[model samples]
Target chain A: MELKDYNSCVQEWADPLFRFAYKCSGNEEDARDVVQNSFEVLWQKRQEVYADKAKAFLFQVAYRQSVDLFRKKGRIQYTEQPEFSGSSNPGNPDLKRVLERALSQLDEQSRALVLLKDYEGYHYDEIAQITNLSETQVKVYLHRARKTLKNYLVSVENIL
Target chain B: MVTLENYEEYIISYVDGALNAAELQELEAFIAHHPELRSEMSAYENTRLMPDTSMIYANKEALLKQAPKRTISLGNWRSYGVAAGIIALIGTAILLWQHTNNNHVATIVNVTINKNTAQAPVGPIAHENPIKKDKAIQQPVIAAVNHRKQARPGIASAPGINRLTVNDHQNNTAQPSQEKPEVNKPVEIARITALPEPKTIDTISPAKVLTAVITPNETMVADKQDEKDPFAWLPIDDTKKQGLKDLKKTVDKTVKEVRSVTNNLKETALVFKFGKKEITLNF
Candidate 1:
């Protein structure tokens, strides 16, 4: 990719990549670091990447740095804890906060898969490409993660 | 296909928008048959996270890149033209300087020749002592030439040496005839006859005289050859012609040096100034 195309990728994909990294790593600082590193890798390999595939390439880098690296470093740490606590309290009825808590509950890989699927709306194959997983694995993991989230939301709804 | 065993997969795919029209209809029909599962599917749909538009990456300007620097090459026609013009100008200047220096040297040579010719006595002078005749003839002419040369600093003294030698020879012959009246008449007559005719020296042009002074032996041979060949009207000395060729070679070498300097300049960075901004392009 040319410099202009790479810069355009930065402008277009930086926010989404940051959000994906943030959701996957559950830390704003780590998310920012992931975004910076992903763009840096993209710039270094700009010649090898095409402008059309730049977004996917960036997401792939972000996914590996945020999910794989964080997992390798041990269990995930949330610098900013989600507002919702897993409790039977009906006062906290915010569905978005409950969903955030639910998303934090999933493993890093599954969370990255879910973020890649829902936030970026990538297909199973594209998510597999980004996460370096088979299409079957992406589908199975995403379904499992969706069930976990649905169960959490159901329990919260029952309490409400 | 949307049975209870595989119902969760269909519900996830439905929420993910992965279900096509037929799969959607099948899942909806299955859900209609199981009204309790409708809320379950709705819970799965709520799991799809909407990206917070407010959670944008701040300072996007930091990720942007500037365009890479471009290299300038010497292939430009303007650069070639400038180099050619510089070489030509340098060559012209060298040639002009050489021409002017040659003319100046020739002028000095002619002035010395004219002065020597005018000062030397036409008639022979007799010397009292034969031993002193040789020294007297040599000393005065050399001293006079040296004194005249010293008067005009930086002029070449080589061209005047030959003219002074001829003048000393004339003086030596005159010494014997004037100082020794008792010497044999035949010997005195032969000595006078041996001397070159003054008319011959007066008749020869200054340019030929200068050529004769530079290469006396070669000039004499060429003169003898000219006596035989009818077409030998222009008698050119080989050494003088070689000197001119050497000067031409020097001018050519100077032009080559100028060309090399210009080529080196092409390898350096070209800087252009526009008001306060300066752009430098490297080759």
Candidate 2:
């Protein structure tokens, strides 16, 4: 792709890619690094990637980088839970925080599949392409991740 | 397709929006029949995460790529040609300047030597010698004075020998001499004894003739003679000396510049042609 197309991709996809990386990695710094490295890889291979495919290429690179980081660091547990100053009621508890805690419960690959699938609204084949998995595997993995999240939300003790 | 056995898959697919319209309606019917499972479907639907729009890449500008700059590569023959031409032009100019400077210095040295020689006292004195040419050549007055000084030392100290005389017989024999005389004669004798003296010539000691041959006046005249001066070949003017120093400095600077240029050129490949052979130099 040309420089202009690459720049346009940066402007258009940077936020979404960063959000995807953040959700996958669960750390702001790691997510930022993944996003930067993804663009850098995109620039190096700009000639081979068309303008329309740049977003997928960027996400693919980000996915790989985030996975590599996760592998290198092993499993990271979310220890610093945000404090809720008001009611301790499970039904009235903050859903965003509950969902973030739920996302943190899944493994790195499963979490990435869910993020790519839900956040970016990628199809099964597209998630498979980015994650280097078959469509059936993506579907099976994504369903398992969704079930895990659903189970976490269903448990009142876990939510409280 | 929407039975209780496969209902979980249907709910998951429904939450994922993977269900067709007819399949979605069938799942809705199944969910209506089993209304208690609708909460599970709601929980599954809540599992799909919405992206936090507030989270942005703060440094998006860093990823931009600028247009590449044009650079002149020495791989081109035209660049090499330009560099070689510049070096050749500088070399030629320096050679021509040095050639002209050397010629100028040579001309100045020649003129100064000729001018000093022309102003010398030797020419007029030699032509005006009154002693018979054959006798003067045979006696060789310098030798005669040396011989007389060795034979009779007392004559060199005589009052008559020191006295200035215009027509003294000793004066004429000593007048034309260019070498320093053996005896210590007064400067007046050299100045007065202009005509060649023939009277009392046999009575005079050779030391007096030797003493009269060279005087303080002639010593100064001899110092001006270019042939006798050791450093006469050097330029005499201070400005000319400074010019030579400046030329030397220019040559040194030019050499350093050429060396630097060649050093820079070493980064590129160079080709040389000799007869039918081609030699390529790469660094």
Candidate 3:
């Protein structure tokens, strides 16, 4: 895409990407960094990037940079096993906190895949492309991440 | 019968809409049998929907404020490098200029002394003395070196010095200072004796030997031969005596004159040519 087109695309995607990044990163500052850095990458590679796929590219870039920030700070681990437990009403405030904590507990790629799929309503193929995984892999990862959040919510309710 | 693992795989595919019609029906029938698995599915769906509650828009203004907006795309570090390069270039130019200036001054002084000394005619008194010649050579060398020092800048860098192949010449010329003891003693004497003595009024001018005296000094000392007061008015040379007689007869001019003498012979000549003009002496 040319600079003009990329700029208009940025205007369209900036808020949504920022909203997702802010949710993922848990802070306005880091969220903005992720979003701005993603736009910068898109701007730099504007010529090579297809205009139709610009939205996916921007979100992927932001998610990846946010993941890198999490890894570098050692706030997230890469190899924890997900736990699944059956529960009722996982969206309550206490269960929500438990689920958010469990969501944070998942690996960055799995967390991003789950968020993109379940929250953003992205297709499995779209998630796979954005996360550089196969469509099957995206489904598997999102399933595991969702199951872990569910188990943590149920277990936390049992404790309460 | 569909197993629990098969059911879970089928359910996962169902969530992704990847399962075909029969597989979706099987997943639905399996979940119907398993109430706990059905509740897990509902929990997963709720978990998936929940992150949006906390989702917030990133504050772009705060991010931009913290990250320092760039006015110029070139970095500060690179600008510093450019500034350093310019300073280095200026320093090199200054060094080169100083070096060339010094060499030019040295060359000029060397050539000037060489030409000037060669041009002057030696007087009879100095021509007879071998010591005078030795002294003359020594004195010129000191003057040449002093002039070279004043004219030659020591700090300047010279590229042409190598290409011109003047290394041996420079070494040889610089070598004389190493033998300065021998050169120094004679140089002092040559400088002192070769210099013309101060003149007295009693002595006539040496104008007859040369063109008009461009740097005439009445105080300049004439050649010192007179010691007694006999015929003190007599001109220093016979050529001057004839010239004065012819001048007095032709112009019939009587000129007031003052002459001081310690001997009969006047120690100075009456006429001399210096350059393009003839100058005659009256006293």
Candidate 4:
């Protein structure tokens, strides 16, 4: 990809990648950094990247950068905003809070697989490509992530 | 019968729709056999937490606005490199021109002034010193190095110093500085022949122009006198410039009686008669 086309790719995929990154890391600032840095990596290796596979390649870079950021910041706890407090359903804040906390409980790889699957609707193979895992690993890890979420939410329900 | 060991796999595959029809019926029968496992199935089924697309897309539009739109190309760089190369080549060409202009030595004349045409041929004067009788005898050799324009037929230019302008013998008395010609190249030696006595003005043959050979040792003695002032044309440091000025002042005070042989000399001509022919030459 040329630099011109890479900028276009940024315009094209920046949001979706940001959306995924924001979901993976619950911080908007970190998400933006991850997206910006991913685009930067794509720019550096633009010669090797094809325009067709640019979206997948960008998401992968964002994933690794997000994971690195997660490690660098230690075990990141999601800080929920006041705007995320009010919801259409009366009980949604609790469920969403429980879900966010539960998602943070998973390891970085498992959280990445789950976010790639649920937020992006990627297939096991696509999630595997993004996370550098085999399809079986993606499936198994995503299933484990779902189990953790369910257990956390269930315990929250039991307390309520 | 779904056992506890693989129950999680059966439940996950069932939720993922990876179970075949018989395995699905069996898992359904097993879940129906267990009631507490039903809510666990519901929790897993509804565990997907999606990012709000509207809020993220709004953020995306703002981020995209901040990103730069265009990039530099390889073609642009090639043009830049080519432009720099042309500028460098032009710079080198200018420096070479300046060096060539400043580095060359000024041309000096090696004429021997003859006071009397009877003792010397009136054809050309080669050196300024009257004391050097040997140089007066080898006047033809100095004529060759300086190649002064001879008034009559016998004088000719030297062979090697071809790219020089020879001063006429009449004007040789004007500038002593011009007489000490400064050639940039190292001073070299050459064999020269003396002019022969003319048998007849009409029979002054070209073969007889170079008649007698002179020794190189005689010219070396004259060249030692010439090396003093040849450095006048070059740029010098302050110390050397001061030294040259001091030397000039000292020479002006001490060398009053030693007049330049080329200076204050009147133009003298020698007339030769060969039977019916007459040759009047200036010295």
Candidate 5:
């Protein structure tokens, strides 16, 4: 890629990618790290990247980086800490807060599926491409993930 | 009754929108008949509207810290190596070149359309230790142009030794005949500049030059195509574009009204209401 062109791409996609990374990792520094690594890899593979394919290219790099970190930390397993207050207090008036806490209770993959589908509003095909899952699998994962979150939210309400 | 275990797959498909029209109808029918499942699905959708405070993973920084720090330094070295290679190649070409050295000198002269222009000094010789004199001379010229392109516009302002020496030579050769007229040219250029023209040096800076060179030709073509096809660059469908245009116009009108009221805040604040509370601006 041309030097100026790459600079423009960084400007356009850096913030959104950082936000995505921040949501996944829950730390600003790690989000920055993911963004930095993503750009570094993008620059290295500049030859393979065309202008139109640049967004997918950066996203793929970031997704892989997030997954790699996730695997390394053994976060793929299902676990939670009752000691923690979770992402929100049980008294928060906003139902959105309740949903967000419910979402965080799920495993990394499920959380990722929910975020991609609901928040970023990716189609099943796009999520499949990014997550390297089959379109059918994306549908199944999203369905299961959403159901789990729904169940978790209902449980929280019942306890209240 | 649809048991939760038997209906789990359908619930997922229903939320994910993978179901066909008939399937959707069936699911809706099931929900209509089943109050408990309907409540469950309502909770599912409420989860969608959740405020996302997802944080970037924390240990990612520590892991990245564990990785080598030399990547940036390595990249810098790679670029430096490529640049050094290009300089060496051009250096070799100059040494091997047998003729046409004067044409090269003339091309340098041709660059100055305005003869009396106060040219900046040429920069330092790029190839520090040249194997040959001819190569050394040519290397500076090629590198100067390349450097100018990459460096800031003001970088060449600090004239170099080579430029000072060249200026001395040009003064001796062309001085007597053109000296008077040349002295007056800067004054005339300065006078023309002083005129109250809307477009001046500020307007013709490198940014505008680059924009004129690049954007307009492409934009002109796009505009021509757009005249025949209105939705060319727009992502919205034609029907949607019409709706969007009307919406935009309405928004603009409302924004203008709001802005006008804001601009007259002191006067308008007398009548403004916010729920049960009302406040007045003293100014």
Candidate 6:
């Protein structure tokens, strides 16, 4: 990887990687920090890494950083949303808000799997590469997460 | 019956596009038969969530501002290192050539001195060592030395043999024995060097020179066959004569080998080309 290519890598991946880090870490500062760390590592290992592998490599690094930052904060397990809203007199319900809440409920790995599959349209294999999980695990975890989201919607619909 | 519990994995695979063509057709056929499972598929499809891209990333510029700088590859350094190594090699070769500019000579002479007190028929002491004025000097034997510290070959640790050396130039040199010799000295000196073989023993050019002999014996006895008195100067008794024959055969072989190896320096000569009148000086 040349210096020019390094700059190109930053230009190409900065936004999507930041988005991934932002979604994983749930904090803008931590996400920025993760993105910075990933690029710094990419800089250090420029010779070994090829241009094609840069995106996967960057995401892999970001995933690890996000996991570490989460673990360091002692937030390994996610604070799941309630299965159904207990509040009576249900008014206007936002599906996007419900989806965000559902996403926030999942643990880091599952959340990353869902984000990679849904938002980025990554294949099971691509998600596996990013999250350091097997393709089967990515598929299974993604399905389980979607089921949970459906369950959230179900609970919200039941309340309605 | 395709129940929801038995094939929920298949349902998920269908929604995620992970199902192969056969599996996808099988699922479609199964759902076609059971329309309720089609609703199950719709439930799965509706729950396929995508995050809001606009809201997810809040600070892109801050991350962009801290981008990476490039590193120089190991390949770049290797070329420079190789170039420096070649230059160093060339420099060392030039320095070595400059250091060793003078003449290169390898000479070895082996002389056997007889312990004869009988002061062999005295004549003009042309090559006599002034240091050993008392000793009888018969013939001047040129025993050259090498500057390089290589041990001279074919040397015997003979007791009671006196050793004297004088670098009086030319072949007028001799190995003088002890002051008072109780027995007759049997001096058998054989020298092999880049110096051309002398034409005859009679015309030895008796110069005012002196030296002792050590050893690299390859005496061309056949080359100097014209010498009427080759072995006459160093008289050998019956025992010494037998030893000389054996020694001469060994010296002949060694001389042939040395000549083959030291082919570079062939008899250092001064060629004087005075307008077609060429005069060669063999040293």
Q: What is the interface RMSD of candidate 5, in Å?
A: 7.0
TM-score, B chain alone, candidates in order:
0.33, 0.27, 0.22, 0.24, 0.17, 0.26
Clashing pairs in 4: B108-B181, B108-B182, B109-B181, B111-B126, B111-B127, B112-B126, B112-B127, B113-B127, B144-B158
List ranges where model 3 is wrong by over 4 Å.
Answer: A2-4, A76-95, B16-22, B50-283
Flag the better candidate by lDDT, 1 or 5: 1
lDDT of 6 by residue, B78-116 (tens): 865575556555654564354333322233233322223
Whole-model lDDT values for every prediction: 0.62, 0.62, 0.50, 0.56, 0.49, 0.56
Number of the top-ranking candidate, with DockQ as the measure:
1
lDDT per residue (tens digit) for residues B176-198 in model 1: 54543323321111111111233
User: Fraction of native Cα contacts kept in each candidate?
Assistant: 0.88, 0.84, 0.34, 0.46, 0.30, 0.39
Docking class of 6: acceptable
Clashes by residue pair, model 2 = A1-A46, B172-B197, B181-B210, B181-B211
Query: What stretches of model 6 exceed 4 Å from their correct place?
Result: A74-92, B1-3, B55-283
Clash count for candidate 2 is 4
Worst 10 residues of 5 chain B by lDDT: B186-195
**lDDT over C-alpha atoms for residue B220 of model 5:** 27
The DockQ values of the predictions, listed in order, are 0.59, 0.58, 0.19, 0.30, 0.13, 0.29
Off by over 4 Å in 4: A2-8, A83-94, B1-7, B14-36, B57-283
Candidate 4: tens digits of C-alpha lDDT, residues B1-283: 5876777778876655557899989888888888778877788776876666665534444333244667889896687567655654565466445533433211122222222223434233233322223333322223333212212222232322211122443334423245334222222221122333322111112222231112233333334443344445668432233234323332442243123212322243434454575555443
Q: How much DockQ does model 5 earn?
A: 0.13
Question: iRMSD (Å) of candidate 2?
Answer: 0.8
Better candidate number, 5 or 6, judged by DockQ: 6
Per-residue C-alpha lDDT of model 5 across residues A1-160, encoded as one tens digit per residue: 6655567677666766776665566556666888888878877787888876777777777777776776676543323324435547646444655565676677666667776666566778988888888988888777777777888788878877
Error of 4 at A113 (Å): 1.0
> Once superposed on the true structure, which residue ranges of model 2 sit more than 4 Å away at CA?
A79-81, A84-91, A157-160, B71-283
lDDT score of residue A66 within candidate 5: 71
